[model samples]
Structure formats: structure tokens, C-alpha cells
Target: MRTRFRARPRKWGPLRGLLAAAAVGVLVFPAGASAVSAAPLAEQDLGSRLAADYEAAFLTQYNKIKDPANGYFRQFGDLLVPYHSVETLIVEAPDHGHETTSEAFSYYLWLEATYGQITGNWEPFNKAWRSMETYIIPAQKDQPTNSGYNPAKPATYAAEHGDPSGYPSRLDSGVSVGQDPIANELSSTYGTNNIYGMHWLLDVDNVYGYGFCGDGSKNAPAYINTFQRGEQESVWETVTHPSCETFKFGGKNGFLDLFTGDSSYSKQWRYTNAPDADARAVQVAYWAKTWADKQGKGSQISSAVANAAKMGDYLRYSMYDKYFKKIGNCTSPSCPAGSGKNSAHYLLGWYYSWGGADASAQYPWAFRIGSSAPHQGYQNPLAAWALANDPQLKPKSATGATDWATSLNRQLEFLQWLQSAEGGIAGGASNSWGGSYGTPPANSPKFYGMAYDYQPVWHDPPSNRWFGFQTWGMERVAQYYYVTKDSRAKSILDKWVPWAINNTTVGTGGSFAIPADLQWSGQPNNWTGNPSTNTNLHVSVLNKNNDVGIAASLAKTLLYYAAGSGNTQARTTGEKLLDALLGNTDSKGIAVPETRADYNRFDDTYSQGGLYVPNGWTGKMANGDTINSSSTFLSIRSFYKQDPDWSKVQSYLNGGAVPTFTYHRFWSQAEIATAFAVHAELF
Candidate 1:
């Protein structure tokens, strides 16, 4: 039921003509390597050997991502936005292939940053930030009502439900909510009340046709969102809506009534920020600054770095609990509302959100941080370190650096607390139990008074099931360890690296296998006390796969750990893994065949784990597809039926063979490209 795009084996598909032309750059090999060398690469030194391969790998992947003909990016007015994938029929995080996420934008920045590091060109990196700002981050025109935001009363409380049938949670003004601690400081520091952060989702092709603020003109790259119901509500069950709601689409109150129940619904504009993506952008900026400085070109990126600092300053919102409630053993909605830093968890939660009534409306705006500090995949210690230590990237706000400095240590401690007996990190801790501030079971494990959840934020397929989170989160720790020789970070990665390498397989003939899925058991002891090792906590590898993106991430983690700790097997495994990945490369990017049996759920009804529309709550998508009790995932957006890959999915729906696809996801490609650069630079 949980169908967000995870790292899976996928096949290559033909490109779709999606954007205007841009000149293709030729690959510039490093000085020590030849354009046509017949000599065996094995004979050369590691640096000389990998320099050519890494440069070529980075350039090939970069050109594939940037070139318009490849269909990875599309021209959105004056700016550009990358697609989720080159194909149109895929289903994952974004329902449609053309729909992009902040994750993609961050990866795009990373791709450009690597290019600047390799080619010494910083224009592309700056341009990436500009595009991110112009498209994803809501402009003054989009928000238009931050002036109405009240720091004293941020947002009213709404109890979260476990399923879609829990008809729009009613807003209760009587519930106590905390004040916005940093709102005034951030506004005074930046001279603006408007948040300077990227909203998590965008419809790059406007496939659903919810044009800007529902003015009705179909436009590309319109802001949109899904996944609001609860942990059980996966992408397959979502009812898409525009970010700037104007009551012109969906039901009478736009799509607001479907998610929240109130006495009177007001037309509004809202956006959710995926903290990990924004954090990754800052992490990328730090690397960009470091690389550029090495080439005596740091000044060229100073402006962009400053903006990253600004974004980081706003990112502190993620440190607070949702509704700004006190962090600890509060088991009810009546739990004490926190003031100042008491609400700060110091860990990056899943998301931070803000919204306001239309600029003309009388109602005020609201902001909320996430209460669930779930998936470790979202943590970025490197970025936290940069914001805390690097003067260039230090946030301009008064307490931003201090907060990040505390966050750096806290994140490391969180990692230490979550590590399992077998060394795999467990899920996470949550201040708001079950997302409603409900009482947790007595004697439940706790981390700093917050309850431990094996699968924190979401529960469809279990949030921490995929091994990708381990590698993704550990890679940052490894990098932080490699840079600062932080004993805490090293101590954590020392156990994680060996466990990951033990599960990974790098064989001859381009054959390789890394952890695909994981199964966890037991829980860590109370970290509020002495924080002992989790002797009872354990993990088992459920499966193995050659998912290129995850493999690249695992390799990076190992390489960084090996580089810092002098672990020979880690270095060899990382090098061999990278070498194996090159064999999977193609014209568009690296991918392998994926058989999508999950596509069968496209037509499933509510009982079968599909979209659940409340009876009589009739509405329509932009294309006029009706939304009611009978609607399935495919029924609401008829546009997908016209996709070129529709027939294969259709056949599968009709009980035929499962369709296999090779997708070129923007974020995965960027990760692969950067993985090569990471190897070359560190080695």
C-alpha cells in the first residue's frame, strides 16, 4: 500500500521530449588519464585509475540529467525543474513521473555542486539555487499573507487519524498550543515574515491541471501535495490538491475540508517542507564552498552559501514538536504546551509546514513542526556541523549557530541511542505517540522521555524496512567522521560499516548484491538514563538487491569510513562496488529491470488498500475525474491512462504478466554521479 519510489531495479525507457535545448558538453578527462588508453586500469595507482573513471562517470551522468533531449528537466518559464523520472507512468513518492519533489531539487543542487567541483564551473550551482527559489519556494505572490501570522497563537490543534475514512479532523481552538519561538527572530533577521524554504512537492508537468492558485490556466510546475491522511494513508490512497488553494478545484472548500474539519473553511495557501531535502541542499552548499575554495573560487559561491545559511536558519522549525508541545512523557492532547527551546527535540523531524488564509481573507496563518522524529534517512550531521562551524554557511539568525551546534551533538547521540545489537540502527523516537499525543503503552521504551517507535512516521510498509535509510544516514555520519574525526561519529560508523559490508556482495562478472529490505526486532533501553548498548535489539536482512542508487550510497558510506579509519575491506568493497555500478550505465543513466507487481493496486478499492473517498463527498480533479466512494487510485487522475507505459500496467491489471521498467529517477542519478565524485575526491 505504501508506494513511494524506493530504490529498486528498473530498466531503461526511451526519452520523452519535455524541454528546450541546451548545448551538450564534451567530457573533460582528468590530466593523468587518456581519452583512449588501452592499458589496464588495474595497473595504475588508485588515484590515477579512478580519476578518469570518476570524471567520465560524473560527466556522463551530468550531461544525461541536464540535456533537454533526455527528458530529465523541463523549462518552467525562465527557470528549470527536474522531473521525478524520464518516464511518465511510474509510481513512488510522487504519483506521476513528471511530478517533482524537494528531494529532486536538492539532488539537482548536489549534481551541479559536483560538476563545479570537477569542472571548476560554479554558475550551474548558483543557477540551481535560483531555479529552486523561483519554482519550489513559494514567492510573495504565492503566500501573500505571512503579515497576518501571529507568534502568540501559531496554529490550532487537530487530532490525526489512522485512515482516510476518519473524516476531516476537526480543528479545536480550545486545545493549548505553544508560541512560535523563532518566528520573530527569523523575520527580524531576514527582514521578512515570509518563509524562505522549498515546499516538498511540485507538479512539473501540471498533469492534474491545478494551475497556479487555481486561476484555471493550466501551467507547468504548479505546487501540489499528497500524503496528508496519516501513517496508513500511502501515495496509492492520496487525493491530490494544489498548494495555493483557491476553492476553484475539488470540493466546495477546495481540498481543505477533506483533510481538516472546521466550522468554516477558508481559502488558503500552504506548503510542507521536507527537512531532509532542505538539509541536503545546505550540505551540498557546504561542499560546494569547500571545493570552490580549494580552486580559489570560493567568492563565486559566497552569495549562494549565504542563501543556504538563510534556509538553515529557517530549518530550525524542524527541531520543534508539532504544535510546539513539550518534549517528554506527555500522553494526552492536554499535555503542556512548550515555550522557547523546551519544545525543541534537536533532531530533524519528518516535515515542517506553514499555511495561511488567502491574503484578502480575515483569518490568520499557522505554522507547525513535526512531532515524530522517525526515519534516520532524514538526518544530516554534516550540514549541522557546517552551520555550526563554517563561517560561510553559519545562519545569520542570533541563535542559529548555537542551535545547530547543539543539534550536531544531539543527532550523533540519537544515532548512538538507535544503534541495534547487530549494529543496524533502529527506527526512531516520537514525542506525540500515535501522532495524536495519545498515551503509549506502560513500560514502553523511551529515548529522552519520547517513546521509541520501530517504524516512526509511517507504517504502510514500515518506514525503516528499506536498507537505503541505513546507508543514506550512515553515509553522513561517515562523512562527518572523515572530516572532523569526531569520536562519537566514528564510534557509531565503526559498528555500522562492518555490518553493512558483511551483508553486501561484490562478485565477478559485474554481479553485486546489497541489502534491499530489513526486519527489526526488540528495542533499545531507556536512553534517558545511562544509555547502555541495545543487547536485545536486533536486525535481519530480509532481501538483497542491486538497486543502483542504494548501492552507490552504501559504497560512499564505506569509502568515507575506509578513508577515515583505514579499513582495507571497506575501501576495496567500496571501490569494487563503484566498478560494478559502471557496468549498469546506459544512455540516459544507470538502471536495471524492475517488475512492478504493485501496479495491480492501481484499481483496488478501499477494502483492497486503495483510495478511500468518503461517501457523498463528491468532487472532481482538474481533468474532471470524479472523486467519490467508488474512486480508485487511477480513477481520480485519468491522465495516467494516456501514458505510453499504460498498456503494460493495464495488462498487469487485467491479470497479465507484471511489467518491468528501467527508470532514470533524477535524485538517484544525481546520487550516482556524486558517488563517483566522492570516490575520486577522497581517494
Candidate 2:
């Protein structure tokens, strides 16, 4: 009975919410109904263009200094500005002439590090790192075909050709929530090659100090040999696949390789001139090292040892030699639909679960990487963390142990074929990349009530459709109910944590690289599926709506990591939705900042100041800036795990005080390891 996902659930039939406010009311939205005003070159002309690029941005420590719009304004406008608002609401009314070189380089790096960590003034972090190096431009031509580093658009380049049912390419390519021509073909096919070159070395080590912004004491191996010559020319000419071996092409290894000869990457995801899954560098290391590193735990143990050597050969040759390939004396089923053990549990669960990385080199029960699975309804928390770490993944089976029990019994039958009749887990819209990849209608739908809200395995998605498939199925079932406590995953985490805190548009107004999946076209997750049009994304199913609650902030960070961490009722329900997120500038001498930008329109001071470095602690601290999607970095790590308890590891072992976007790897390693694996299954 591999049928597994039978379906039927949909409920929220108009006006009703508070099962937890659809996963804890929008984590980032300071003011809505589209406020309006300010037309730019103003607001003190962006602090006078950061006082004219403040001495090459104090040479780099203050960070930004040379981008100029080709690099999407310092990664979505200066590191997604003190929590994004499209520079005081993109010219009013439903957002006029929208702005985003990545939200104007995150609003010039929060106006020079929120006025240089509060009036100490590195001259507004050296003029907001030179107004985030005027959105860093360069590749307007040079390498012609595709050499990498490509971020140009602030002329708002609106061509808009995308909705051929290929689900959501920013709402089928009507394309212009301000710049996303498939991120310039994902920076010329996965950033000039070197496939995910550590996500363009985390925007050249957070705007030039070095790569993936690490090795920094202000990095120097001559800056890792001048950024490994753009990471070996983006891994030998634009990720055509030159890690040398290990499957060719890029993304889904460009249509499953029989190895059709000579490669520059391109095996599965797509490339015979590229068709669907635009594969925006299939999340180059989640946004390369979880939002430009330097937040704590020693760069989280050097980003979990280079994410265990980039998923250590897909947990040893795609789940221990392709799930024993038919089993001993074997010779068959190598790639065919096994899809290299579910693409190594979907890129090691978005890079070791947001780089807090649960180690042993991520191999969560590796049943040939959740083989023949994907119809959608959930099961890819990076292949259930390598099939729940199948005893311990690796190739030790020639003897001396480690056969991984028939691929961990198909990894608990692919997580009970991605459950749904209401018990939760709905990411099953399977297209394993080849032909007819079925199963994903929010994993099947019809689960008895909620008017059968199945719709989310991708119908229309250029941004936040299917809430990135229910935030990738509640981040692979809240990291499998925090590492297998499994009381039926704590009774579907108690009815999917109030159906994702009362029903969905995700934490309210925090989305940027949006795409939640659920559109055949009528459109209305509060409507802005902005893929260029009067809109078109719906795939059918319908009912519940709660303004698309970040798919209920993944059950409000899995009931605040099952109520163990900082839990005073999920930090007074995340400081009462961060105090109903009004129009920015709350200016209490700005410090405890966070953002959730939707602003294509809305003004009258929609908050600007920055310096949000929280977690285990670092300096000035920040959080807001919510939309590079995946439900705006998982609700900015579930709004800093609220903080009623573990006072960030008891104020960093006592010395106390911390939060410049503090120690977070998805709220410090997968939300306190799912709060010690669902601490005694509450709910």
C-alpha cells in the first residue's frame, strides 16, 4: 500500500484564526494597506549616499563599498536593509515602480550599520558601505555567454514572459517585483559555474573582505587567492559541472546523467536550454552560508566543516552506493528515478538545516535518498536528514556493519508517504526532474476539512506560491519533530501546530524571493504573487487562508522548539507579533531590530535604522529583512526564538549580553535540535 498520501484537509472557511495565529502571525511586517510617500534620492538622500561612499567603506570592515546594481544592491539591497521596506514603500499604491537590487542592497546595509552601531559613527558604517557600493555592478558583458557574478536590473527591466504553467517564475514571469530575470540566469548558470561556488562566496564574503564572508580576521590568503579566481571561474566556465566528476551539469545534475559527455554542470534540475525549475543556483548554500556569516558559534564550527565537505559525496555516493543498487551481486537501478538519493536529501536539508547543521555529515537514515518519492506532500528535510541518519551514513557495508537496514526501510516508507489527512506533512508535488513527477498537490489534499486546501506542491511560483511548498513542508517536518521523537511525530506536531498558527500568508508581511506554491491562477495569498501580471499561479485546491501565514511559521518554530527554548509561550508569541509590525522607524534609539518587507507601497517613515546582531551575541544585533524566501529565512529564525529561556545559552556562559543577529543556524542548530527532539512530545 505505497499509496500513503490519500488527502483531504482544508478548513479555514472565511474569518477565523488563532490556533496560534497561523504559525505565529507574520514574523516581519511593520505597516500595511500599502502606506505611501518618499520617492527616493531623499530621506536625507540615503544619508547623502552614505556621505559619498565613506572612504571606500573604511576599506571593508564596515563591509560594502563597490557593487553598483549588477550585484542586486548588495544582495537584495544592502543586506536586506534593517529588515526591508523597499526604501520607504516603492512609490506608493500597491507598490509603484517597485525597487530591489535585493531591496536596494538591503537599504544600504541598514543605513551604514544602523548609523554605525549607534552614533559611534564609522561615518554611517562608512556611508552605508558606499551605499552598499551602489548595488555593485560589473558583468554587463565581458564573459559573454556566462562567467558568473550577474546582478543587474534597477532600470526595472520589465519584459515579463514567464507563466507557461511552469508554476511560478515570480508569477509566471510577468517579472518585476523589481529585478529577477532568473537572477540573470542565476548569475549566468549558477554564478559563472563552479556550481554554487559557496553561493558566490556569500556575496564575495559579505561585500568584499573575502569569500562566503569567512576566513575573516579580514581574510587573507591574498583573500583566498583573490576569491579563488571567482572560484575557478565559477567551477570551470559557469557551473557546467566542473567539480570535475560527481555527476555533470548543475542543479538536478541537468536531467539525470547517462553522462552525455563534456560538461559544465547540468545533470538533473534542468538545462537542455533550461525549461522549468529555474534553479536559481538551487539555493547556493541557502544564500551562501546562511545570510553572510560571522553570526556566532565560531561561524558555527566553520559552517559545520564546510557543510561536511558539501554533503560528503551525497552521503557517500548517493546514499551508500545507491541504496545497495538492487542489493548485493547487484548491477542495476543506478540513477533511474532514484535521483541520487533524493538529491542528497535535497542539498543536505538546505545546507545542514540552515547551517546550525546537525552533523555526522548529514545522512538522516539514507534509504537511497528517499527513493522514488516526490509527488510532493513532504519528506525532504534534505531527505529526512539523510533518512534520519540511517544508523550513521557512509560506506562501511562491505563488512564491519552499516548496511543501513534496507535503506532504513525506505526511510520509514518515505515518512509514511508524506502524511496529510490532517496529520500534517504536505510537500508532495513530485517532478523528480524528468517526466511526470507526480504526488505533490500539497501532498495530495482533501484531508476531511479546511475546504481541502491541498494546492501547494507548485502550481504558480516565482515568489511565495505554495509558501515554498509549505516552507518546504514545515522544514521537513520541523526537522522530523526535532530528530525523531516520533509519537507519530508528536501527533502531527499537534495537528500541525494549529494548522500553521491559524492558517497562512506566512508571519504576515515578510517575503522577498517569494514562492509558496498553490496556484492555478485565481491568486490571493493576500494576492502579491507578482510573477508579472494580473497574476495566474493557483493549482486547484482551496479553503483556508489566514493571509498565508509563513505556512504558520513552521508551526511557530515547532511550538517554539517544543516549548523548551526561550519559551514564555513562544516569547509572548514572538513579542506579540513584534508589536503588530507597523511602519518601521520605531526608533527607540534603534537596537532590537528585525524586518519583513513587502513594501512596493507604503510610507510615512516605515522604519529605517539597523544593527540587529542577536543570538549567542556579537555586536549591535539585527533580525528583520524578511524575504529571500523559504518563508523569509524561516521567520528570521522564528523571530529570534523569542527568548523566555535559554537566554542565548545562558547569556553566553554568563559574560552576558548578545544579539547582533546572534548565534543562529536556524535558531542555533535546527531550533535547539528540535528542542531536544520534541522534548517529551507536548500538544
For candidate 2, report its TM-score. 0.24
Q: 1-683 in candidate 1: lDDT tens per residue?
A: 01122323222110110001112335434333234321223434333465655665566667677777889999866567899899998887788889999989999999988888887878888889999999999999888888888877878888878777885889888889888799999999999989988898899878888888876677667988887887777778888888878888888888888888988877788888888889999999999999999999999999899999999999998888888888888799999999888988899888888888787786666554545454577789999999999998999999999999999988888888889987899888888887789887777788767988888877777888878889889988988889999998888887888889889887754568888888999888888634357898899998887888888898889889999999989988887787777667666777777777778889989989999887788888888999888999999978888989999999988889988888888888889889878887887
lDDT of 2 by residue, 83-191 (tens): 1121221111111112122222322333333222222233333343333233221121111222222222211111111121121112111222121122233234223
Best by TM-score: 1
Error of 2 at 236 (Å): 31
For this target, which candidate reaches the highest lDDT against the unseen true structure? 1
- Model 2 segments beyond 4 Å from truth? 1-419, 427-498, 501-579, 583-585, 588-651, 654-683
lDDT of 2: 0.24
lDDT of 1 at 342: 90
Q: What is the TM-score of each candidate against the true structure?
A: 0.94, 0.24
